[model samples]
Target: MASAITTLAADAPTLSAANTGFMLICSALVMLMTPGLAFFYGGMVRVKSSLNMLMMSFISLGIVTILWVLYGFSLAFGTDSGSLIGWNSDYVGLSGIGITELWDGYTIPVYVFAVFQLMFAVITPALISGALADRVKFGAWVLFTALWVTVVYFPVAHWVWGAGGWLFELGVIDFAGGTAVHINAGAAALGVILVIGKRVGFKKDPMRPHSLPLVMLGAGLLWFGWFGFNAGSWLGNDDGVGAVMFVNTQVATAAAMLAWLGYEKLRHGSFTTLGAASGAVAGLVAITPSGGAVSPLGAIAVGVIAGVLCAMAVGLKYKFGYDDSLDVIGVHLVGGVVGSLLVGLFATGGVQSDVAGLFYGGGLEQLGKQAIGVFAVLAYSLVASALLAFLLDKTIGMRVSEDDEVAGIDQVEHAETAYDFSGAGGGAASRSTAAPAPSAASKKVDA
Candidate 1:
C-alpha cells in the first residue's frame, strides 16, 4: 500500500509548472496594485503635488525590488537565523535556489515565490507613505524607504512568515499578512506621522481628495488584485483554494463597504465616494488575516466590525492631534486589529489545524493566543518603526523644506506634473488659462 501511494505520488502529473505560472501571474497582478495605490493616493492629494504622491508609490517598485533581490529576500524569507531574522544561506543574489526547487512543499518554483513575495515587500512600505503625503521630501522619503525596509519590514516579515519564526512558533494564523503587512505598515505610519508632525494647515484646511474618480479607480484595482493577494496565500492549487477564502473575500468586502457607507450616512448625512473606497479597503484589510481560517459569516462579522471601527478611528487624529494624514491608523491599524482579534471568536471547524476558535467551542485559550499575537506584533512594530524613523531623521533628515512643500513637490522634486495639457490641444490651454491661482489674500483667508 505504501509503495502504491509512493508510485502514485511520483507518477502524478507535475503540476509544479502550472502552480508556478499561476503564482507568477498573481505576482504581476499584485504589482499592478502599486500603481492602483498611486492613483488611490494621487487622487487624495492636492493637484499641486498629485504627481509627487503617485511617484512615491511607483518609486517603491524600483527601490524595493532591487533591495529584495540584493538582500531583502534573504533577511525576510530565508532560513531562520534566530527569532528575529533569516539567514542568507539558501538563496543569495538568486544563487543556489533553482527555478525548479519547490517552496513550502508547493508545486511552484522558488523564483516564483521570491517574485510574488517581492510584490508584498514593495507595497507594504508604500502603503505607509499615505500618512506622510504632501509634506515629506522626495529624496528623504527614498532614503527612508531603504532604511525602513532593512530595519523594520525585513525583520517583521521574518518574524511572522519565515520558517521557525517566533510568531509562527506561537501558532499565530495570518493568512495574508494582517500583522506583517497591514498592522505593521499602519503602526509605522502612525509613528512616522507623530515624528514628522502634521502637514501644513491640516485640520484648518479643507484638504479634500483632488479627484474622486482616481480614488474609485484605485479601489477597483485593489479589489481586483486582492483576489491574488488573498487566494495566492494558499501558494498552490490546493483543496483550500475552492473553499473558505473564495467566498469570504467577496462577502467580507461587500459587508465592510455597506457598513462604512452606513456609518457615513449616519454621521455626515451623505454617502461620499471616498467613504465607499475607504470602506472597501478596510474590509479587505480585515479579511486578510482571517480569510483562510474563518467561515463566510465570520468574514462578514470581521468586515462590518473593521469598517465601523476604522470609520470611528479616522476621527481620532483630530481629537488626539497625531496627524496620520491619510488615516493609516484609522483604517489599517484598527481594521487589522479587529480582524486578528475576531478570528479568535469566529474561526470555526477544521479550516485550520492545532486549534479552534471560541465559536467552535475551543474557548478562550485560542482567543488569548490571538490577542497575544496582535499585541506582540503591534508593540514590536511600533517601537522598531519609531527607532528606524528616528535614525533616518537624525542621519539623513525626513521632511522637506517648508517652502518646497508650499510650492508643491511635483515641480520642486520631480520636475513634472501629473497632467500636462501644454502640448495636448487647444482645450488644454483654455483650461489652464481659465483656472485662477489662489491670490495671496485668498491664501491668507483660507489659511
Candidate 2:
C-alpha cells in the first residue's frame, strides 16, 4: 500500500476526459431515479396519501446526500477495517482528496467516483419508503432514514463493494448492486413493516392505485435512467463491458415485461398495465447485478424467472397478512435473489469475469459464494433495520393515529393534497350551475 501511494505521487495523474464526462452523466441519470421513484410510489398509493408517498422518496435526496458527504462515504468506501467496515481519516467531510487525484486505479477523479456513488447512497433508503407508506409518521420516517442508512446501508455497502470487502473478496459477481442495494433495501423494508404493522385498511380495503398514468410515466423514467445505473458501474467504456451491460439491461427488461404479461393473462385473464410496469421493474432489478456477467440469452432467462417469481411473490403479502403497500419485497428482494444466483448458472466466463457458471462448466463454487453474499446482506439488514424501526416506534412513534391515517396521510403529514376538490362554492354550486347534457345525435358513433 505504501509503495502504491508512493508510485501514485511519483507520476503525474492523467485524467480521461471521456470517462469523466461519461461518469458525470451517469451520476446525473442516477440522481433522477429518486424523483422517478417518488412518482412511481406516489401513483401506486391512494389519492389521500399520494403526496406523502412522494415525499417519502423525495426526502432521501435531501437527507442521504448530506450524510454521504459528512461521514457516510468514509465509512462505506474508505480503507478497510477487520473486513467488516472501513475508515479513512482523510476522507472525513470529503476534505482531504485533491480534485485531480484519480480514484485509485480508475481513470476518473476521486470526486467523480464519490459523487457518482453519492447518488446511489441517496436512492437506497428511498427504496425502503414504499413499504412503510401512508401510515408512518413523517418525523419517525425521517429519523429512520438517517439511522438506517448510517447503521445498515453504509456498512453493507462496505461489505459488498469496498476494497477488501468480504463479499468482494469472496468473488461475488455483483457487477452492480443486487446484494448491496436492492436486497439490502428490500430486506430492510420487510423488517420495518413487520415492526410498524399494516396500513389502516390492509386486506379489507380496495387500496387500488389512484393513477395508472403516473405509474406508467414513472416506470418509463426509471427504464430510461437505468441505462446509467447498470452500465455506469463499469466506470469506463474503454473495454466495451459497459456496452454489453447496457444491451443486456434492455433485453432482460423487455423479456421480463412480456413474461409478466403472459403470466398475468394466464392467471388473471387480463394483461393489466400495472403488471406491465411492475414486470419491467422486476426485470430491471434482476438484471442490475448480473447483466455484466451473462449473455443476452442468459439475460432473457433471468428476466423470465424473475418476472414470474415476482408476480407470484406479490400475492404472498395477502396470504401471510403483511401489508407491503408497494411489493418492494416481491420485486426487489425476489428479483435481486434471482439475478444474483443466476450469475452462477448463466455466466459465460466471457463478459465481466473469466469464471464460468454451472452451465459453462464452472461447478457450484460460484453458486455458494452468491448465496453467502445474498443471505449475509439480507439477514444483517433485516435484523438491523427491524431494531431501528422498533427503537423509533418505542421512543417517538412510527405509525400515525388511526383516525389521521384513514382521513388522509397527505393532509395530516404535509398539510397538502395531490388534488383539490374544494372549488369556490364546493360541489353544491357546481351541481346547480351545470350545463345541459349532450343529445344522443351529438355523440359520435364508433364506426
Candidate 3:
C-alpha cells in the first residue's frame, strides 16, 4: 500500500486535484495576512489615528485586488518580456484562462496561481502603510498605492520569480518574498517617509501604542497565516520541503520572540508585550527567505539574530531622525536582509534545492547573489516610491494639514473614531458621541 501510494503520487496528472485544492486553501491563508496587518498596524498608533491605520491596510485589499485581476498579475507573473518585466496582457481580466488548465509548471489551475499571487500583491503595499501612519492624505495614499505597486512591485516581482528575470537567472534565493515583498516595501517606506517628512511630534511625544492586545492579536494572526506564506510558496504540498518550512517558520518565530524579550530585558529592564509582538513579526520576516534553505538550527540562529538586530535597528529612526512610524523599515527591511543573506551562510543540501550555504560548504556565491538581489530591489523601490510620492505631493498633495494631523487622522480622513469610550459603562454613555474636534467643529460653523 505504501508503494502503491508512492506510485499513485508519482503518476498523478499535471492537473492534480490535491495540489489545486492545497493551493486554493493556502491562498485563503495568505489572504488573511492583510487584515492581520491592519490590526497589527492599527494598534501601534495613537487611539485617534487607529481607524485610519486600519484603513491604510484595509484599502489595499480593495485597490490591489482590483488591479491584480486587471493587469497587475499579468505584469508580475505573466510570461517574460526580458529580465525586467512580464508584458503579456492576455491575462488582463484573465482572458484565455481555462478552469482546469494547469499553470506553467504546477498542477494548480492558472486562476489558483493568480489568486495566490494576488494576496502577495495586496499585502506588499499595505506593509508600507505603517511607516506613513497618522499623517497621509487618504486620496494621495490610495493613488500612491496604485502607482508604486505598478512601477516598483510588479517589475521587481518579475525579476525575482518570473521566468527570464535577471535575478532568477542569477540564482537569487528569495523563496517567498524576502526581496519582492518585505525588503521592497521596507525601502519604499523609507523613501516615502523621506518625501513626506516626520510626524509633528515624533521626537517629543510619548506616542505609546494605544492597545498592545490588538497588536498581539494581529501578530498572532500573521504567524498563523505565515504557515501558508512560506510553505505555500512551494506551490504544492508534495514533499518534505513544505513540512520543513512549516517547522522552521514556527520554531524561528518562537526563537525570535524569546530573543526579543531577552534583548528587551537587558536593554530596558523589562519584557514588554510590544516587544513580544514585534519580535514574532521580525522572525517571520527573517525566515521568509531562508527557511527552505536552512536547517532547524539555522532557523533558530536566524530568528535570534533577527530579533536582536531588529530590536536595535528600530532605535535608528530616532538617532537618524526618520519617523518610521511603526518600524517597518527596521523590522521588515532589516529582517529581510538578514534572512536573505543568511541563506548563503546556512543553506544546506539536505533541503529543497541542492544548493548549500557556507556552513554546508557552498561558499559565498549564494551570498553574493542574495546581496545583489537585495541592493537591486532596495535601490529600485526607493527611487520609484520617492518619485511617486514626490509627484503626488506636488500634485494632489500627500500630507494632511497640520491641524488635521494633530487633531487626529481618523476624524480627518475617515470621520470615524476607532473607539467611543464615551459610550462605555452607562445610560448617558449610550447617547455619547465623539468629542468635538476641529473637523467636527467645522460642521457647526457650516450649519
lDDT of each: 0.85, 0.92, 0.92
Q: How close is candidate 2 to the true structure, as a TM-score?
A: 0.93
Q: How close is candidate 3 to the true structure, as a TM-score?
A: 0.93
CA RMSD per model (angstroms): 5.6, 6.6, 5.3
lDDT of 1 by residue, 202-296 (tens): 78987888899999999999988888888887887667643577688888999999999999999999999999999999999999988888888
The C-alpha local distance difference test score for the whole of candidate 1 amounts to 0.85
> On a 0 to 100 scale, what is the lDDT of residue 297 in model 3?
96
Candidate 3: C-alpha RMSD to true structure equals: 5.3
Model with the higher lDDT, candidate 1 or 3: 3
lDDT, candidate 2, equals 0.92
Number of the candidate with higher lDDT, 1 or 2: 2
What is the alpha-carbon RMSD of candidate 1 to the true structure? 5.6
The digit string of per-residue lDDT tens for model 2 on 1-447 reads: 999999977685478999999999999999998899999999999999999999999999999989998999999999999888899877889999998889988889989999999888988999998888789999999999999999998998999999988998889989889999999999999999999999987898899999999999999989988999999999988999999999999999999999999999999999999999999999999999999999999999999999999999999999999888999999999999999999999999999989889999999999899999999999999999999999999999999999999999999999999987666454887789988976776655522
Tens digit per residue, CA lDDT, model 3, 1-447: 999999987876578788888888889999999999999999999999999999889999999999888899889888888688886767988887888877886788989999999999999999999999889999999999999888999999999999989999999998889999999999999999999999989899889899999999999999999999999998998877988999999989999999999999999999999999999999999999999999999999999999999999999999999999999999999999999999999999788799999889998888899999999999999988999999999999999999999999999889998888864664676448636556867988987
Ten contiguous residues with the weakest lDDT in model 3: 422-431
